[model samples]
Target chain A: MVDPTESPATGSSIRHEDHGDDLRTVRLAGRLDMLGMEPIALKFTSLTASHAQQVLVDLREVSFLASIGIRSIVSSARALESKGGRMALLVAPGSTVEATLTSTGISEVIPIHTEEAEALAGLGAAG
Target chain B: MAALTPADELHIQPDPETLRTASLWLAERCRQRSVPQELIDRLDLCLNEVLANLIDHAGPGVLEIPVELVLDPGDRRGGTPLSLRVRDGGAPFDPTAAPSPTAPTVLAETGIGGLGLVMVRRFCDEMHYRRVNDFNELTLLLAWPQETPDR
Candidate 1:
């Protein structure tokens, strides 16, 4: 059976693919805001508690990032960090996530990846 | 000399979905009164700002504390003005006195926080506050465009 926590929105396959070795990948799209973000946060919370290495959030498909969405990402990052892990993001070129980060000064705090492979490679947990 | 609607004093601490439903109702009320879309949009953004701020700063209560929204169609803008005060009992800091942020360089995150007040300022004329007793009295003032003389 497919684990329910791994899937995001229905009809669209928003999968958090397990890369094993404590690294995971998730894809996002459309507008990510307060309404569509709680579940994503819950999933990250669940995974990060058990695995204490790192989680890669892929915003390559996400168009916009709101304040609420940023809150969730940061909250999850702190949760993992407490357990000796970290969070990085894979951002698409010219996406709003970059502006949101830089504007909020998270580009200096929240690590960014231009490509998914690069993020996994950076974690050195590449599978 | 007109009386305020009964909703003038209604206070509800609602979750996201219920809060959204209530917001739709509020929008319909504004639309019925011909409030401009721009003003309505601002009101909606104001709701998001206060609610998100409350959640961020006002949790861990063991039991869910009521996130209060107090209505005071209390004749602020003559008879047509409805007033809303969304208060967060969290950390007790006044956003009114909080420093401003217009560009990226002006912001510094103590950690994971910066954008809420930014969006809030973009949407409202002013955020008023007074610390009364122990709770934060955050008053977000929004005037309906229909109520404006030249709007």
Candidate 2:
């Protein structure tokens, strides 16, 4: 089941959608800076904990990506991985978000796909 | 040598909200000057990390003293490096001297404490830190592309 309500604590909008077959998609939009990471991190951790198969993080609408934001994603990915699950990120090519992910060497650890289809395929969630 | 005057300056409270204000200020300045988006993003990232560190570790005194950011676009026509100076009147903490965190090979090994400094080091072309008087001043420099020439 997807949580449609956005938490006001983080000031960033995050909602989850169940793709069926135990696959889930969490879409995050707005700035993912220091202030915005707190609620998102908590929500993401809880979501990943509940859905143990696969979680696709869509960062297409994330206009800003900071170190703390990266930390949140990495931490959530780690949490999911521990439960035998995986997290993949969808980032547009040539975006600041993509560049930050690459420079921080996050792209090496997390699978980054430019297209939704590619990310789904990589996560084995393709229909 | 002509004294480098700050193109802009901001005095902000040492709070998380400053990150958003600082980023917007930097972005607007970059857009007006026709600075490349890549440089703008790097600058924004570095500023956010640096400010976040100060806010997190600068102790309670940071609330009493305002954090200052000075932007120096040195000879934009001649391709001199753009510099940002973040001044905080908190306990002396030199980020440049801090141990660089090794990039974790796996997800579980990734801890959040030292990664900010690592990103600051990697993105900025030059970094210098000085504790003069009671202020911790950290400066980051980025080389402007000569080919683009601010257009």
Candidate 3:
């Protein structure tokens, strides 16, 4: 379990690992509501701004996601798109997070994959 | 009619930090009632959106007026529905009046605003708003799924 104490923020913690070939995978855990979106949004925007290639956000561990959280993802994805980069999301099957993304039509704008390998491949193929 | 006590109530300052506190209070109440995780997630999401909207749009006078959250459960249509009433004396605003933004098809046209209200409406089964005595009261209702007996 990713501890919320890991970050100074109360609701979320984000950790990224380089997946080789310039692909970055970010794993987010905990509630991604208004209180949680601030720090994570900054980091996510920075990652997409700096990388500008392929960034896969894995939300399988995320227990809750609100509109602010959705805004962060949309903003980051838009930022990447402006620079000809791409953002993909890994959402667990049948999870509430997935349902929220689907309901907001975000899944249509950004590619959503249930498997990490597929998300990486989709992003890889985009480049 | 007699005044009824809420199952749980929270008085909070209209700020970003208090959003988390409110969620925790709801989570604790749900835990005590053995609410399912999925339903709990829906409640948390709606709570965050509603509270964030109040904090962002409700003006500086909102600071003087503490936000109130009241949680109660009642039987509705043969299922127990959880009700969350958010009362704020900040300003007169009706979220239901806000136009729902259409989902953008293209990434470049995607917007950040108005999506919060959309999520609040999408997750909760029912939503209502009223201005009473200079207070904005928004009520969100979610019907809990019928639980199956253990085999």
Candidate 3 local lDDT, B1-151, one digit each (tens): 1223346789998677888788889999888777777778888888888888887787767766888898885553356588899999876889889899988899899888888888888899999999999898999989878767679
The TM-score values for the models, in the order shown, are: 0.52, 0.90, 0.89
Give the distance in Å from residue B111's predicted Cα in candidate 3 to where it truly belongs: 0.8
The candidate 1 chain A region of ten consecutive residues with least summed lDDT is A4-13
Report model 2's TM-score to 2 decimal places. 0.90
Judged by DockQ cut-offs, the docking class of candidate 3 is: medium
Q: Show model 3 residue runs off by greater than 4 Å.
A: A1-5, A8-11, B1-6, B76-80, B147-151
Model 3 lDDT, residue A52, Cα: 63
Stretches off by above 4 angstroms in model 1 are: A1-14, A29-31, A125-127, B1-15, B18-47, B54-94, B99-115, B118-151
Give one digit per residue, the lDDT tens place, for model 2 in B19-94. 7888889889778777788888889889999988877787766766988898877766565788899999988889
**C-alpha-based local distance difference test score of model 2:** 0.81
Candidate of highest DockQ: 3
TM-scores of chain A across the candidates, in order, are 0.80, 0.87, 0.89
lDDT by residue for model 1 (A12-69), tens? 2245667666777766654455655655666656654455777787777764466777
Which of the two candidates, 1 or 3, achieves a greater DockQ against the reference?
3
